[model samples]
Target: ALAVGVAAAALLGFAVALTVTGLDGPEARRAAAPPGPAAAGAASRPAGAPDTDPDGAGTLREGDSGPAVSELQQRLLRVPDVYRDGATDGHYDAVLRAAVARFQLWYGIRGDESGVYGDDTRRDLESRTVR
Candidate 1:
């Protein structure tokens, strides 16, 4: 009787092990990028936050002008490493928030969505750009 009980316990343990092992899938293992500060909180930051470029030195190129997003910027919206969601239509909305989060995550900066791309974010973007 005791032997039968031990065998049943072993079988149960093996089944459980198999079940747990089988649960590993692409969805389960999606390598989520590190999270940034909450978007809502970051957006309303005080005027004089710790900024990289307070003087507005980094001007957007021809396509980067206006609230309208550029193609390159749109491409950035798709990069998983960049952490944006949905389309990059140049409006500084949630997608841009995610992009800023990605930028902050990559550069190890404290996330603050001041809407102005600071020197650190710009520098990191410049360094990572593929010519």
Candidate 2:
């Protein structure tokens, strides 16, 4: 009888420990926020909805200049308090690179000043914009 009671107590203690530890774990918290209104709206809108660019990138058809370049330009534009020397012509010159580096710093992208705003940089840019 004593052994039976001890075993049951041990099981109860294990269950309580699991519940308490899991409650405070990292996965318990909700996500920070949904994606930007534009992107979220785009998905909900009808397929034929007007030419609104969902990603918050400016409206421009594919194959014009290049989607990658145009999207980068838009991301740069979205940076708050961003002061560009001139326009975002997709040139990726020193001026644009500097702007991107500043953006990287602001957005918490480590080592983003490599003069190449690749996939990681793009993801960081998008996440910041969405939030």
Candidate 3:
């Protein structure tokens, strides 16, 4: 059983190496990197200005929830037939994602990913909605 034990040890060592190196690839590394100056600037709003951008990171997608999601729902409701259910429940569910995608299609908001409430979508929605 010495041969089997050696093979198991080798497998364990390979697994440890993989874990140490991380298998998530370059995208994970880039995401883990600290934000640059431009990203930092975009994350901060001017003093005394309204916090119109949801979540402050300027992006929201499915599975997010909070006041920001509620605000997004309200804004989407402002546009006719965009958020028909009109539930402002603070949860970014499938309905909200579909609404966001519909709004992006109707308004030509191609800068952000479809079904995502990114900076471009937020700017356009805020500009169109009442303060």
Best by TM-score: 3
Residue-wise lDDT of candidate 1 within 20-128, one digit each (tens)?
7674455334322233566545666776775333424553322244443454465465456674445545555555555665666766754234333555655656566
Q: How high is the CA lDDT of each candidate model?
A: 0.54, 0.60, 0.85
**Off by more than 4 A, model 1:** 1-55, 59-68, 110-116
Candidate scoring better on lDDT of 1 and 2 = 2
Better of 1 and 3 by TM-score: 3
Clashing pairs in 2: none
Residue range 1-131, candidate 2, lDDT tens digits: 99999989987886576577775445433222346877787889899866543333342222234656656776777777653534556555566666666776776776333435655566777887773
* Best candidate (score: lDDT): 3
Error of 1 at 79 (Å): 3.9
Show the lowest summed lDDT stretch of 10 residues, model 2.
54-63
The per-residue C-alpha lDDT of model 2 at residue 48 equals 83
What is the Å distance of residue 91 in model 1 from its true position? 1.4
Q: Write the per-residue lDDT of candidate 3 for residues 41-72, one digit (tens) a residue.
A: 76796767654544346689999999999999
* C-alpha TM-scores of all predictions: 0.39, 0.42, 0.58
